[model samples]
Target: MDARFLGITELTEVPSVAVVIDVMRAYTVAAWAFGRGAEKIVLAESLDEVRALKAVHPDWVALKDGPPAEGFDAVNSPGLLRSADLGGRTVVQKTTAGTVGALAVKDASLVLCAGFVVAEATARVLRRRECDAVTFVVTGEDGRAEEDLACAQYIARRAAGEEVDAADHLRRAMESRAASELTEGVREGAHPDDVALCVELDRFPFAMVAAPDDSLMVLRPYAVPR
Candidate 1:
């Protein structure tokens, strides 16, 4: 069962467990949000949707996402997150790829947010659940980014019961970007600094569990508590 992989359009079903990945920045920001003690995070696919979510959850924080030039409330860059004043607030985030992917897989039995920043922790969470299926939803820029596929392969290798070689995985992932027809402008908007920040494996000691309300619940990195 773990050998299977699926790409989804909308998150409407729940599997026994699900692993959501927004590797470029969304998941990284999510982790940072928790680290800063934010109460929760509501993920939306579009800027309009995020604004609407914020309207109702006024106390909740809102992040607009898009290319840097377009200027979304929060750019999908990790460097920006590190400085954000999330001392005590909930953030509603929308991103080019990450958040939307998260919204797509809402139906999974359990959704655990992930990225290169939290890959090790995420994998540990998966082992603890021992679910019948684990889905990794990749968020791509304009619906296409080599990074997403690289992340998928990384997670897929882990799910396949193979050894996960971080260096090798990154190399493989980067190779696609090198060959991609996409432009530097689209890729650079994610920010090189942000990419570096997000790709630091096991940097955080926590895993984010998605709540019924689509917000996240922070859990210790190792496993779930009884």
Candidate 2:
């Protein structure tokens, strides 16, 4: 199997399987949500879609830019979700990087969302599936966030049957500009705890897979083979 790592902007060619990595927040939060019993997470490319989904399904938690809407449960912060009661609830997530990158791969045979939390599980699944070709989409904030790039490289290395030192990757990611912003509270709506959680590699034993369910793209957890 051949694996290629590319940033979100270089997604001109879609592979048989695409793993979208967003370690700074997005996919890390999604993994936490799933671990906390979230029924499913719908990936929205735009804030407008998130609002529309919330309007139709008032019970769903919507995460958009800036503060969360009135009566909404939370924003796009993994730290906030840590205390949330997402039991049997659906979450609608719209982020600038992760979800956008996931939506861009229109031709991928399978779409998987990844972060440090689900890195091992994602790699195991990819190896199990044995796809002829796989692409790692590092959905960095703007151009190429260091955290996302590190997480993507970790997964790529694991999928290629290499021993990965997750701690080293996490250390590098924690020192990145994106991590600095989140930790120092420079980025609005970002929490330091979110960055802490994002860098905890292999926190979960399942990978989030974006599968088509009717008209929506639902993120469901796939348990990694032991």
Best TM-score among the predictions, by candidate number:
2
lDDT tens digits, residue span 62-133, model 2: 865446567456777788778888899999988878888888774578999999999988989888887678
In candidate 2, which residue ranges exceed 4 Å CA deviation?
none
* lDDT, candidate 1, 65-168, per-residue tens: 55554323566566776777776787777766666566566666677777766666666666555655666665554434556556666765664556877886
Off by over 4 Å in 1: 10-14, 56-59, 67-73, 141-145, 156-162, 178-183, 187-190, 214-226
Using lDDT as the measure, which candidate wins?
2
lDDT of each: 0.61, 0.82
The RMSD of every model to the true structure, in order and in angstroms, is 4.2, 1.5
Task: Assess every candidate by TM-score.
Answer: 0.76, 0.94
How well does candidate 2 match the true structure in TM-score terms? 0.94
